[model samples]
Target: MHSSAVFLIEFGAIILGLGLLGRIAGRLKFSPIPLYLLAGLAFGEGGLLPLGASEEFVAIGAEIGVILLLLMLGLEYTATDLVTNLRTQYPAGLVDAALNALPGAAMALLLGWGPVAAVVLAGVTWISSSGVIAKVLGDLGRLGNRETPVVLSILVLEDLAMAVYLPIVTALLAGVGLAAGSVTLAVALGVAGLVLFLAVRYGRLISRFVSSDDPEKLLLVVLGLTLLVAGLAQQLQVSAAVGAFLVGIALSGEVAEGAHNLLSPLRDLFAAVFFVFFGLHTDPASIPPVLLPALALAVVTAATKIATGYWAARRSGISVKGRWRAGGTLVARGEFSIVIAGLAVTAGIEPSLGPLATAYVLILVVLGPLTARYTEPLATRLSRLTRRHRPDTSAGDAPPALASEGPALTVDPDTAMSGSATHMTLPPSRGGS
Candidate 1:
């Protein structure tokens, strides 16, 4: 068969599988990440077929996915949610990244990879699956809840850490050795990032000016700006994800309601193409020899994120059940990890590590949805344990099930920042870029 035709068949098959298996996973109470990963495996390297993947297409879709995902995330950033609660959340976000990154890197080193490959592996493992978290939260109808803002903020912080760390790591891989120049570049990027944050903070000028219901105008302007900024960031030797995220952040307010109309169609089409190409890249037969190591790495990656994220979430003052739910929700690795791993591969960081990274993501994606599918039941049990241990406490303090409505939004004299956009000024809640 012609490559193009085979590619289309594989793409169609994947989409079909995702939809069907997603429903199946829903019924089985399993997370969908594992399903997607399994789909990749079945259709990819070791499966019944291969598509001879195109790195370019997958990379682009992954890029846009991060942008759209983060754009939506940023719009949720009201003044109260982002600005007023930094002291605690910011530190906790750093801790979350550190806790995940350090252990994963150590594990990689134990596998005999040196510091550079280990670090790259660590970055690949460090990020949690934001897409899975968002899906489960929305399904539980908790996407708009107060805790969501906190979780979203932490995810944002992780992205920022990756944006900074990626360039430094890339430089090291290139034999730049983390010199003064790299440090200076990192600092400059931070300062520039702060400027971007400030613009998002007080500058409602763009949103107030060009906001519209026209999807074409919005997509062109919003996506064009994202691409431009992404290009600029690349010129500066920074991660393009940073630039794309900043563009999304700046346009968050203007695009929130109409975002689906503008980006969803294009996102769906392009993203499908992206995944198809991603599947085609691997020769599944080649993965057999490394499967054990990959599985081992994947297990460590999931455990580290769950344990550390749970600990960090708890320390951030979330309830025990909230912590477990958050940690479990984050257990999946998705497009972002794949993007970074692909980058590592392209840059020649280490030949073997690239497949290892891909294998790790595939494993996590397959397992994530299965875990998330049953999250509520598990959360209920955990919440019960907490309640039994302390019966006198109000239910309001604990994370409630999705079937229940949370405490009615109430005004607190001590904490007057209600759900208004003005209240969203909580210091760029936990985004990475």
Candidate 2:
């Protein structure tokens, strides 16, 4: 058999496997990431059918995947939504990312990994799976009113942060040591980004001129800008994902709709390829040894993030039930974790670390959705317990009712007492009633 034909056959098989597994996972109410990983394991190296794609090709495919994913992410933006909802959501996101990540990083260190590996792992676990959380909550119709804005804001914030976070992690892992040179390079990159922002901000005038004359031209311009920025960021040793995100943010302030439409096809194609390729790269056999540690880290990751979100929501004076629901909704990790894990591998971590990270992600993806499913019942019970154990209200007895001089308004009108009263009124009710 020709090598090209064999490669095509394997790739085709993997793609079909991904779609089938995704559908199966969805029907079973499980997160699809784990299933996708399984699909990869099934057809990838060391599996039933071994693949022959070079790591270099997979790496390039992954890069394209990140960009396209970011581009699609841009399409879901609304400034008014951000302004109205992100005020509180941003803080929760920051806290969730920080608190959840620190403990995970510490755990990684305790496991005898390098600091860079630990930080990378921490960042991966820190991010919540906004896509999954929103889908679950939206399906349940719980993502409305107060919870909607908070969750939306957090999702947007996480998306934006992933841009910066991806680059930082990549640099850290790529031997950009925590020395003065690295720090200087980082600062310079930041300044360049600021300059680019100012240029794009002012360039809106030019954009208006172009958009007014021709909408298609406007889209082309935005596309060019996105690629340019994304390319420049990569040139500067920053993550292209960060650059792509900035492109979205900048274009977000102007021509966002057009930018999204222009990027959509490209993004979709890349994203599909990314997920399928991601599956191909992961090997299930590599996950067994690290299963226990990954599980422990997954537990810590879920617990800390869930608690942080709950605490943050409670501080906002939300009911305990709301806190738990919101917390559970925020427990899932997202693409950022995979991106970080990839960086970790690129940065010279032990071969085992990549598979371990994959294992960690698979566990979280499974656990995250399950948490969403059971959150309501758990929250209801917890809230009930909290109410029952309150010091202000004694258990096993109803609190005293407020005394009223007037008759009570009961649903039953047969016992009503009224004298020339046109309104429907109920009779006087007893203390028990």
Tens digits of per-residue lDDT for model 1, 1-433: 5877766765566667667876887897545545555555566555776445433445566566545554445444433344444445677676677776776688668878788777777787788766666666556655443345556666766765655676666566656655754764665478456746665565476565547677778767777766777777766766666666555455445454465456665654554444444444555665666678878877766676667556666676766555665666667877667666656666776666755766777787767755544553577777779877886756567665643875577442212334643334334442321
- Residue 282, candidate 2: C-alpha displacement in angstroms: 3.4
**Candidate 2 regions with alpha-carbon error over 4 angstroms:** 53-58, 78-91, 179-225, 258-268, 385-433
Alpha-carbon deviation at 90 in model 2, angstroms = 5.3
Native-vs-model 2 lDDT?
0.64
Q: Residue 167 of model 2: what lDDT?
A: 62
Give candidate 1 misplaced runs (Cα > 4 Å). 1-85, 142-150, 180-184, 187-194, 316-319, 369-433
Output the TM-score of candidate 1: 0.73
Per-residue lDDT of 52 in model 2 = 77
* Residue 58 displacement in candidate 1 (angstroms): 5.6
lDDT, each prediction = 0.61, 0.64
TM-score of each: 0.73, 0.79
